[model samples]
Target: MERLNKPLTTRQERFCQSFVIYGSGAVAARAAGYKARSSNRQGWRLLQSVRVRERIREIQASLADHRGRANDVIIGKLEMVYHRAMENYQYHAAARAAQMQAKLFQGIEETRAELAAAGIGRDDEDRDRETPNNSPELAGPKMMTFDDNSREIDKACTQMSTWKKRV
Candidate 1:
């Protein structure tokens, strides 16, 4: 329901923060103290509220901006380290710093290229996607979590072990 500039209640505020953290509506609702059984329903209802939606968007936008700023800060510090290492005749440290800088820039460039290929304008998308931590930027080995039949695998393994022992 849309209301005229309604301020979010404390629980609503907590829900926004938790939603951002977990990226799950039901989980966020539970974290915000909603009844466990009704958390999913409450989360859906909260998302329907215009005010709540706006707050979530605002929170996400701020985090995106902060992430971008953080990357810039990191690059700047790396540059300083590179210069200092070179001045101190620490060739190894200087080379390491240069390598890190190259990797960081390469990641950023890859993300930009991906965005372009996907038809996302540099200025139009959220800044977070351009950072090195983002998958397109990281472009290397990644660990994936899969929810497979682990219990069944365990059972099968145990049965196989027992059969081998008997044989």
Candidate 2:
């Protein structure tokens, strides 16, 4: 199962991409063309593979790095805006900047909460906590068919494209 350094088969690549998008083994398996009835089992098995897990981690790390850089730029600009507004004695502008900063902080807080809820940031000893798995980063509509699963993949691609454009 430890084949992370090896080349993946086409189906394996598809499965990895889909899993990265939706974070569901069953949905990703189905989207990768596994039989519907066996998708859950196949997906579970695939997820257990070391190669698959590694690929998923790689994708997530890349996204996180990209997002972190974007956030740094945004926060820097927001800080500048806040200072400029204050220095200009524009109380309304300053208030707006404050609101925007709050909103940005709230967004980060929400993401942190979501990651914690998803069992992502939990330590081994904290794995037994009763928090629900409701991470927005992996949330998607329940996939009833391959089309539904592929839709999530499409959305992920679109999001990456938009992020690149912004960057």
Candidate 3:
């Protein structure tokens, strides 16, 4: 009796069996004594066409469904990580702000203590005179001099020198 799906050839049957076992068209084609390496590429392309593509799509849809369930687990883990990072950032910021405020208050208190120790009240008038002006030239004592005879003496010296040089 003839088989319903008779083998294309004995070699073809062996090629199909080798492909199924090894999952490699190149190996199977070589085993089946196909001359060109491209014959294996064609075999692989044919396996991906039409009926084979539909079957593969079904398997891939099943895998995608499984991955969707795993995505929920990964999202939960990532949310926990996000919340932890935000909490850590907020805690560090609040701690740094508190530390800064404490340092500022401590500096103010020390300044107040120093003022009290020096017997200088905050509104003392002596502090105003003692406050140094920023200008270097205006900070020292001012001097003024008036000499009416100096110009006449300078003119006499100039005329005397000119007369001496000409002689």
- The lDDT per prediction is 0.69, 0.66, 0.47
Candidate 2 vs candidate 3: the lDDT winner is 2
* Candidate 3, 116-158: lDDT as tens digits: 8999675442243232764433532221111332443344445
What's the ranking of the predictions by lDDT, best on top? 1, 2, 3
On residues 1-167, what C-alpha lDDT tens digit does candidate 2 reach at each position?
Answer: 37457887899889998887666899999999999999999999988888878888887777655544455445645655655655665545555555676677678679879998888884442343233584543432221222433443354445545663343
On lDDT, the candidate that comes out on top is 1
Clashes of each: 0, 0, 0
In model 3, what lDDT does residue 126 have? 29
Q: How do the residues 41-127 of candidate 1 rate in per-residue lDDT, one tens digit apiece?
A: 999998888888889999977865664545554565566666666567555565566667668867877987998999988673444
Model 1: lowest-lDDT 10 consecutive positions: 140-149
Residue pairs in collision within model 1: none
Give the higher-TM-score candidate: 2 or 3.
2
> Model 1, stretches more than 4 Å misplaced?
69-106, 109-167
Model 1's TM-score against the true structure: 0.45
Q: What is the TM-score of each candidate against the true structure?
A: 0.45, 0.42, 0.23
